[model samples]
Target chain A: MTQTAPRPTLEAVAERAGVSRATVSRVVNGAHGVREALAERVRRAVEELGYVPNQAARSLVTRRHQAVAVVAAEPETRVFADPYFAQQLRGISKELTAHDNQLVLLLTEGREDHARVGRYLAGGHVDGALVFSLHLDDPLPALVRGAGLPTVFGGRPGWDEGLDDVVYVDSDNRGGARSAVRHLAGLGRTRVAHITGPLDQTSAADRLAGFRDVRPDTDPGLVARGDFTSGGGERAMRELLDRCPGLDAVFAANDLTAAGALRVLRERGLRVPDDVAVVGFDDMLPVAEESDPPLTTVRQDIEGMGRLMARLLLRGLDGEAPEAADGAPVPAASGVILPTTLVRRATA
Target chain B: MTQTAPRPTLEAVAERAGVSRATVSRVVNGAHGVREALAERVRRAVEELGYVPNQAARSLVTRRHQAVAVVAAEPETRVFADPYFAQQLRGISKELTAHDNQLVLLLTEGREDHARVGRYLAGGHVDGALVFSLHLDDPLPALVRGAGLPTVFGGRPGWDEGLDDVVYVDSDNRGGARSAVRHLAGLGRTRVAHITGPLDQTSAADRLAGFRDVRPDTDPGLVARGDFTSGGGERAMRELLDRCPGLDAVFAANDLTAAGALRVLRERGLRVPDDVAVVGFDDMLPVAEESDPPLTTVRQDIEGMGRLMARLLLRGLDGEAPEAADGAPVPAASGVILPTTLVRRATA
Candidate 1:
């Protein structure tokens, strides 16, 4: 076995500096009230001996771990398959790194792991938490709140009960969806249809509401349900084609769904923007750009949302005011909702 | 502002149990020599008070943080764009969770972040590290070695200097590439072309060596360089086509590259598996399964590699022998190379 050299100790530094261990401790920890001459001697001795402070001992005195927990309640497959989580994580990681805080990821498989997460959070490991609770029925938010840890959510949490002070960062899903549908309708497509994502998620429900805002009295046959996946989109698209073959346009809930719809349209020998214009939400670069005709979609700053979540939580931890994107102070409970834009591409 | 009740402390538990603080600490720390009745009383007091151990305080005496650092030396875009990192993280997360250990993710953008990562590792914040150093000349390994942290590499590292006991977990990239080329050769493909990933990565270099092992006398024009991306694959495919128009088959370094190659082939009006057969590596489900005609590729146990890396590191930290996938004890420095298999699909 390869052996490493013994690390320099605080005692050695104190002895080398001709000072007591208590004096050296105060200087090493940056605690004031030490003589400048003695402090300088200790600093020089520390540098010469290459003494590194033990984080555990420092954290015990400071009551700060310098780490934050990033908890996501999603299956591994789903988390890896979608780009949304990746973008958000990148944003969170960057923000946390900038603040010199460590990101301790806690990925929960399901309800079974919720107790474990709650225990870990309450165990005083991390200074705070950045949680992603997408589904309305997910109990993670409630559990985290019970843990008494400062937390900022990744998206608009759907739970209504005990949500008074639950802060989160989310894209304007309804507004984005409205813009997509309005764009399609403005293109002289009177017979427009909508493909909805899983309604259990707040984002999906909001997108559906946005679609309804444009086509309030549309026929039930024009709306088909998708699970925000390519396969789901294909099935939904085929169902829409069967129920309303004369439909001139389709707005999917997300880019992955749109990619599936495009494949189905191509198989049915339909030309995009000619036979049937299509618009999708979430301009996920890989899916939106790589699609057959590319995809005209709503662009949300996914990474920004993540960064904001971290900022909000960190601010809360520091007892500072939370700020919006434009640097305006936001009430602690109100949270921030970022606007989305329509990205034009070949599809619509 | 909403305020949480103060947490119950060890002193509170001690008072409740009618014992000294030192007695409560001994029982809570599971120290031997405590009377069974006294320990039971202390445990009851802890449960009644809902007292949770302070990780920092406990870590001071135990010298164990119950945390591991996962360091990846890749830009956020690349790490998220590819599915490999996600899959590996999932595997590592599962194993760590089972062991009641936390995973601290440290993502480095480039050379600038190396010093910060080194300082963190040297600070003794984590028990060990799982490092992913892809490039041949990456200096991270040397820095980590200097920090004297037990580390397990995600992929086979390329550095040869001071590499006596460097442990790593890697898929048989060369063997997997050889199998892909041999499968193409078995189909009577005499002019088999190869598209390579960035040559700086050991995996890409090993795959290229495997291709040479099969087609020792192949024409130089049959090879093109790709950066393991769809765009890179498209350019490489077009170059291969221009250089050797008669090439019957192409083996791409990864699934994303193959997807790009497939798109270019379709645009040029070539029938898949008829006019030109294509094979890819790393059967990343999304890209491989969603490509034009799906993709015939080599499957590596990516998640398993992560799990093994964690297992190896944890065992080393515990002063136990490192075991291979089959549970056979191996020398620590020998490392473990997992086997890969070929998965057939529509394209080939």
Candidate 2:
């Protein structure tokens, strides 16, 4: 093995300063309890020895690393390829930087990685965690809970049980879908079809629910599932057209899917907003603006949601926010649901 | 403040097991020197007490954290919005997982973040670093060097001094640009214009250099600067057209820029390949494949480069790789350059 010079330790600094290890550590850590003269002597020793305090040693005194883990359980490339996570990451990074905290990103690959994530959180390497557990049957919510770390979920997790007390920051998925479907219905178009995102995710399921809420007695054939990909959207759109030839309006789960459906509609020589009105969710600007008719989409403040997630997490970690009017400790249920608006364009 | 159960300490476990602290530590760390009977006793005590060994204490003994910092100093939103960094992150995650290490992502926003990054590295929180110092004036390359950590740069950093021994992994940018320009020239398209990505980045500069190397003494009006955004590409294309209206071919620095140029060309009543043959670099599939008429561009193995960066850093940390003719230590210049290929499509 290649040899390098040994790093100076606290013990070496203490010996050089003719002081106890505690005194040297206090001076190095900037603790206020050390005497000025002794602190100066210890500082001189540290400078002379070129001592960089060991992280493990420093963390023991401070009980913090000023770091947070951002876990993304996206095994599929489509999710990352899209700009959704990118925008959210930007928001999170900005907030973390402002707070003088470091972000440790954990992109879990599959089921096997769940255990690794669990171990990392349990190790107390980070102050808290901000997790994106969007899909149903994601064991991360439970694993994070079992680890007992302060965590904030990015999106509304798809869990029917054991997550009511979990803190999360999510866009109004059900409400956004309601707005989209209502807009389509307001266009005097009956036989409205819903192109759903992957039903395994809560956002997609919620959107489907919103659609059903509007057209409670509609035919089941109007709803087709998509995996939030252009190809999947195309297949779903084709199926919907094949099943419901008279359908005049559609609400796609996202802009990319809407773009795909638009392509199919154009190929079939159907005019948007006349023969058929189309509205999409997540006004991810590039996909939304680039759609043939400049897609009318449900605009959620994605970056704002990301910022709120980090903010809520940091506040929870602080535990001294003046939110408890009753003088009892603040509960962990600081769940936030941001509003979404309909972005009108030529497609609708 | 909220109250939680205090974590059981090593002292409690040792006392409960009626063993020395050293013996308990050895048992907890899975060291083989301890007697099986004593180890069993310690394990039982640990289980009964529900003691999770403090990572700080464990790290003190091991002198390692098994973590690496991934610093991306890209302030521009366009960079993150692209799939380039995401694909690289996936590759880095996969490779780090295989090696049983953790990834700590540091997204530096501006010059202010450089000091924070430097302090974190010098704090010794991670064993090594993988930095993407793309821009010419980025201080990260210098800061990382000053920290004296084993670092592997993700791209060919732009530095005229003090980085001769810096190991990096980059795609064959110059050769890729050459192939693109040569392909357009072979199509009998004279007065070919070039839309360059932000000149501050070495990749863009190298591609520009490659263009000039082939088309020596080209008119300055044929080169338009773009900021690697679709809007910037459109603006640059407009400027190029205004300066040299007869330009029959275009080579954009990236696919996003090419997409923008395509939009402007179409709006100006010019048909691609027939009116203006186009070539682009960094055939990021989403942008390249989805662009109108599809983009004929340079394809680089972005994920492979990320994996290579992590691999080189890890190998350096291992310090036992056979690289010398006479069993000497491996030099610090293990730079890797991956080849890029010209992907032919409808545009050209």
Candidate 3:
């Protein structure tokens, strides 16, 4: 093997600066109670020696990697194609950069890749993890918990055991769906149909439940299932139209689905808000804005939720006490659910 | 600090398996010349102890971290919003997962973050890097080269010095453009206009060269500049119409631009293929297929390029000799340019 260039060590810096190892360590860690003169000497020595503090070496001594893992649990293409993950990732990037931490992205494809992720997390490569797009019955949540590392879920996780103990941030899915349906109802569209996302995930299920809360006796034919994709939405809308030709309104699970539904409505010679008023969830700016007729949708603070997830994990890493209620410290498992708002647009 | 659970060491595994320390080490590293019975014993002991090989420890011993940094050099929302990155990431993720390597995602927001990235790469946290979306004035390429870490550029990089030494993977932009113009000429469309992407990028520049290659003395008014976005495309298309209202055909630099131009044409009451024929680059499925009239486009193997980049970096890590021609070893800086094909669709 070729000989590699040697890096300067803390001991070398201490010797050059005429200080003890402890003093150099304190200066590097920015701990209080260090003499200003000694700290300056160490800093100057570090600059002269071009001594970059090796994260691996620091991790070995302090048991902190100064890095976080972001596991995007998207096994299929639909979730990855959604602008939701990109917006959330942008927010996470800003927060992580501010903290001087690294972001390790692990995109899990399916069950086969889960073991690899489990080993990586358990192997002490990162201090904490932020996971997203978890599906019901996924073994990843359990494996992540088993790793015994600080973790924050991006969405409302769907595991049976220790459900209340999982730290997560989520939008008010049920409430958003309720508001969307109510908007359609207020628009006086009585025969309202619904196009839900895949029923396997919690967000889709919650949205379906919210739709039922508004119209309990709706025709079974009026409800169709989509996969949170425009293609799937088009298919579902076509089925709904065939089953209930007189339906006057539709609530889609997301903006992409709404875009698809709009295409079908236009093809079928139906004018938006006149033939079928439409409302979508998660106002993904590009899709919602670009869709023909400009979809009326529920706008969740997706980026804000992403920022919150990172902040919560960092707080746990700092060992700060969790917020308390009634003089009792709340469990770290507690999460924050951000509110969602309905944005009125040309569609409704 | 709270006590962390002690991890089982090689010595402990050796003792449990009734093997020597060297034997256990060889088994863990997958070295050859180990007896089958002894290897099985060591494997069982490791399983019983739940030993996950410590990446940090292994990295220290082998000088290989098994982690590669993927720097998304886009601070703007456009790159993230584009499905291009998602496709590339999927390919990179699949390849890295297969190799049991981790991906460290470094998203640079602006100039300040560039310094942070330079420091991180120079800090020895990862083995190699894969950088994307390099702009004309980006100093990242030079910094990465100075850090002495192996790197692969996603697109044709925009560096001026040692241009032959910059390893990258790019599509045949000039060739693709030639084919697009040829198709228009074959249709006897004389007043062909061009919507060009930002000139700083080599892809956009090369596409313009190809357009000029076909129409050497085309009217100056036929060329308009766009920024590889739908909005930019709309503005550029309007400008092209203002300059040459009777233009019969257009070749957009990208699909998003084409989509934008199509919308403008619709608003202006021009018929597609009848009044104006359009062709776009980057056959992005959703955009190309979903446009009002399915777009004719130049299809580049984006995912394949991403996979090849990861493969090249991994090969460098493995110390494999580069391919040779005429009995001379090829230079490591050599790159591959994938081909592009024109797919005929509704508009053209």
In CAPRI terms, model 2 is classed as incorrect
Q: What's the i-RMS of each model?
A: 3.2, 2.6, 3.0
- Assess chain B of each prediction and give its TM-score: 0.79, 0.77, 0.78
TM-scores of the candidates, chain A only: 0.79, 0.78, 0.77
Chain B of candidate 1 versus the native chain B: what TM-score?
A: 0.79
A1-348 in candidate 3: lDDT tens per residue? 999778998788989998766456546754323456777999999999988886854554346666788887765354466568878877777676667666666655567777667766766667778988558977787677655566789988876554544578888999999999999999999999999999888889989999999999988999999999999999999999999999999999989999999999999999999999999999998889888999899999988777777777766666564232123232344567888999999999
lDDT of 1 at B251: 96
Query: What is the CA-based DockQ of model 3?
Result: 0.20
lDDT of 3 by residue, B225-259 (tens): 99999999999999999889999999999999999
Looking at candidate 1, what is the lDDT of residue B231? 99
Query: Which residue pairs show collisions in model 2?
Result: none
Mind giving the per-residue lDDT tens digits that candidate 2 earns over A1-348? 989799988789988998766457546755433456777888899989999988865664447667788887775354466589878887887777777777777655576777777767756567778998877887877777655466789998777553544578888899889988899888888989999999999888888998888889989999998988888889999999999988999999998899899999999888998898999999997889988999999999998777777777766566444332223232344567888999999999
Q: Which candidate number has the best TM-score?
A: 2
Once superposed on the true structure, which residue ranges of model 2 sit more than 4 Å away at CA? Answer: A1-62, A179-192, A241-249, A260-278, A289-297, A322-333, A343-348, B1-64, B172-200, B204-300, B321-333, B339-348
Candidate 3 chain B least-lDDT 10 residues:
B322-331
Q: What is the lDDT of residue A101 in candidate 1?
A: 69
